[model samples]
Structure formats: structure tokens, C-alpha cells
Target: MAGYRPAVLVGRWGEEAQLQEERVRDFMRRRERGELLIQKIKSLQESLLQKTELSVCKDGCVHFGDTVLLLNPAPAEPGPGACGSLALAVPLEDSSAYSAAPLRAPCGVSAVQGVDPVGRNTFHVLSVDGTAVDEPIRFGQKFGLGTTGGFSAQMFYLASDHKSFLRFATKSHLQQVFLTEERSYLTCWKAAFWDPQLRLEHEGFPVPANSKIIITHCHTNRSLAVPRNFWTRSYFGKEYEVVCHTYLDSHKAEEDKNCWEIVTGDPSNRDGSMCDRPDPQPGGVRKELCEEA
Candidate 1:
């Protein structure tokens, strides 16, 4: 009643019945509008929650705006001690698992588990929306690429949770790569699709959907990697160890630990059908995924 103003009747003083009718008509109109607004909101929620198609991935092409899954192509390198392949995922906060470091391992360590690709592995690939560039991610692009004092012209992704972002930290002797509910400059990264065997450089420039690639932290220069030999147990069971470190002297095959295959879409959808190796364009077939440190 404080801010509410009753409808003013424009007619005569003895028109009490007419005034009552006008008030009822006004109330009905307000109720009708409110119901219409609610219906529109419900329709929108249904569309987003049960999407039929991803706007950026209709053709399964790796577009900038697509949400994706980063999967290690598995023992991309086969050593006697390799753990084969695994998908990187964040642990649930309420789950009963913590990083059990070696007896001498440092304190305050954070651990992320490598398991099969699932809902916990979803990420949104994003670039500046109002930029001059288009969305399809391309090869030969720099990842975690920036000068010490330069502005970051990089790409990054967010966890499906919306509030979280992937972060690379060197706050300790070990390079700590963890998922933070907060996003910052360190959340930035880039994609590389240069497979030595498949020929990285002729014109396979635009990264096709489902291609094996390397994602590097924008500020750390370390690729997201999983070590099959470094195993651990979680509430879910035995899982591989995931980290972000670039081996300075790694050989061609040894570097496969850094290789990840991007499967497009929300993890809830469980769709990786877009993953297919791009036919290396017919020209310069470079058989290396990295450069010398």
C-alpha cells in the first residue's frame, strides 16, 4: 500500500460500481502479463537444458564458442610404464579424495584425477566475442603464448560450473595446475593441432572437430598432461595423475603426454562423435608437435 497507487476513475462521483469494474479489469491485465512472462521463461529454460544442437558445432567443426572435452589420446606414447589414455576431470568438492603426496612431497598440493571422459570434463572454448577474428580454432596458433610484459592475446575455457576456470600456478617447486572456481589471467590457453605423423602444416590450419591437439597454459607455457604411471586412488577408484609441465628434453613420442583430443559439446550430452583426424593437407607434412626449448 505504500508505493501502490489505486486506479483513478475519470468518470462521475456516484459511479462506485463502474470504478470497481475498472479495478477488476486492470488487475486481470496485470495477472495475464505475469503469466505470459512466466511461460516465456519456462520455454527458454527447456531449450537450454535439453538442447537439440550446439550453435557453433552443427557440423562438428571445432569452433571457438563450442564447449568441449579434453581427452588424452592415450599412451600417445607407449613406454613400458605408460598408463595408456585417460580423460582429465575435476573432482567433486564433497567427494572423499585428496592428493596423497609422496612422503617428501610438498604441502598444500592440489591434485586432479585422470579418468574416463564424463560430465566432470566439460569446458567452454572461448575467445573475445567482439574481436576481429572468427570462431573456428586453427592450427599453428600459439598457446599460453605471451611475453613477460605484454598483453595476453590468447584463448581460454571455463568449467561447466560457470564460476570455475582452469589455472596454472608455480607457487611451489612443482608446477601446480588446478581447477579454481575463480577465473583470471592464468586461465587463458591455446590449442595446437600439429601431429608429426599426420603432417601438421600444409593447410590443416583450422582445427577440425575431434582432432588430437595440445593445450598450453597461456602464462606457463606448460601443456596439460597426464601421466599414466603416476596413478592414484580416489573415491571413484584408481585414476591417473594429471599435471602441467613441459619436459625440456622430451623426445617426439615422449611429448605425447601433452596431446589431448578435443571432443565438442557439453559433458551432459556425452557427444564426441565430431572427433575425426583431419586429413593433413597435401604439402608440408611436419612430423613434430613441439619446438626446442
Candidate 2:
């Protein structure tokens, strides 16, 4: 209204308009780049989820992708490439009925049952006589006798009660009996705890279904052997020195049979009465039996 605007003022207003436009364009470009980066992050997350989905096992174990969560941490801390106390995860669907159920026992005895990762029961100790024996079979504890017969046979006798010195007559095949040491018969036996197939065979013949294998611990004291006088009263009448000759020259092929013999004692009484047998010499078999044999 005052005639006309000054040239300098007009020029300044034009410059301000151009600066605003440039700012708008720069903001738009930055927003576009930001949107593209967000889309790429979303796409990567979707791809990783598809490859490894988290799941839970029935035994209350968690499986995150391909890695199993460790329930019990190992004694030594887990380092790189080391699976800390990670055990084989047993799926809930594969759990056996025996393992899933709580262990039940009569009065005065407590039975604790736990299932292994493979869903096998770790506490069931099967007796050959079919009677349930709740006593835990310790790793290094002395077990019953392992005998062999001449016709290529092996038998296990459970050391159970006082009524009979050798309690049960449960017999298992030699092949089923796992001797930890082939050279020393006194070594601990390796019992099969878990075999998914549940078949232990020698020469195509499977072991008996009722056979209860014995588990052995290698680190335990080697002195945990069956006492020499274990079957003295049962086999003879009184206590007599008995020696276990696991290997013999005449019966080399039959290690199980004739493995035991009276070192010094007389079983002359048929009525289970103790006879006055001569004492064992420093290093000699029974004097009377030596002459006869």
C-alpha cells in the first residue's frame, strides 16, 4: 500500500522460501531411508524364527532352537564349544509308564524313582527269582555269585537272605552278563541300563526278558570282591576256607563252571553236620581231596 516493497526485502523473502523447500526435501529423503531399514530388520527376524523355533520337552526340559537347556550345570563351568551339563533330552511322548509313575514300596523302605533323559527308569533292580528286592545295587558293592556250567552256561545267584546263604536261583545267559574286565572275573559287571531296542543277544539269541543286569563302577575300590566264606555254611556244614579258581587248566573253556572249590575242609557228613577237617596248610589244596583227585 505504501507504493512498493523494497528490492532487498523481496530478495530476502525469496531466499527464505527456497531454504524451506530444501529442508522439506531433505526430511523426506531421511524418512524414506529409515523406513527401508526398518523393513529389512523385520524380514531378518522372520527368517530366523522359521529356521529354529523354540519347543519344550515332556521331561520339563527346554529346547531353544537346536540347543538344549542345561538343567544341572556341570562341575566345571561351561566354556566355548563345551556343552555344560547338558544331557540328552527325552521327549515327553517317549516316556515309559514305569518312569512316569511314582515308585511305591511297602512300609519301612523308601524307594526314590527317577527317569533318565532317554525315559528309562534308573531305579528298577529286577531280581531273578521274581521277588521284588528294593535294596539298591551299589556300584562297588559285592553282588551274588556268577557261576558257569560245562555245557556253555552262566548263572547269577542273588545274595538276598539268611534262610538260604545264596538267596535266589535267578539265572541269566553268559552273553547277557557284561564283565567289565575279561581277564579278571572279580571285576564289576556292566549292566545294561537303557537300550532303546531292548534286545541284548549273543549269536542271535536274545537274553531272557526277566534278566536284571548288574551295574558296575570302575573307580571304586577293587577289593570289593565276594567273600571267600560266602557260601561256606550253605555248600558245606561249617566255616571252611574256600578258594575261587576262576580259571583252570583242565576247564579253560568253561570259566564259569568248577570255578569254586574247597581249599581246606571236610564235608563228610551227609546230615549237614560239621566234621573235624584238618586246617589249611600254608599253600596247598585239601590234603584228603588232593590224594583222591
TM-score of each: 0.51, 0.17
Q: What TM-score does prediction 2 earn? A: 0.17
lDDT scores for all predictions?
A: 0.47, 0.24
Which regions in candidate 2 have their CA more than 4 angstroms from the true location? Answer: 1-11, 35-54, 64-293
In the range 1-293, model 2's lDDT, one tens digit per residue, is 68676654644788898999999998788557544445433433332112221122232211111111112122233345332221111111211122321111110110011111111101112332222333333322332322111101322221111113332211211111121112232333222222213324321221112122222322232111111222222111222121212222353232222111111111352211111233465466777887898
For each candidate in turn, give its C-alpha RMSD to the true structure in angstroms. Answer: 16.1, 28.3
For model 1, state the Cα shift of residue 147 in Å: 28
Q: Candidate 1, residues 15-66: lDDT per residue as tens digits?
A: 8887999989987885676444455334333321222222245655666555
lDDT of 2: 0.24
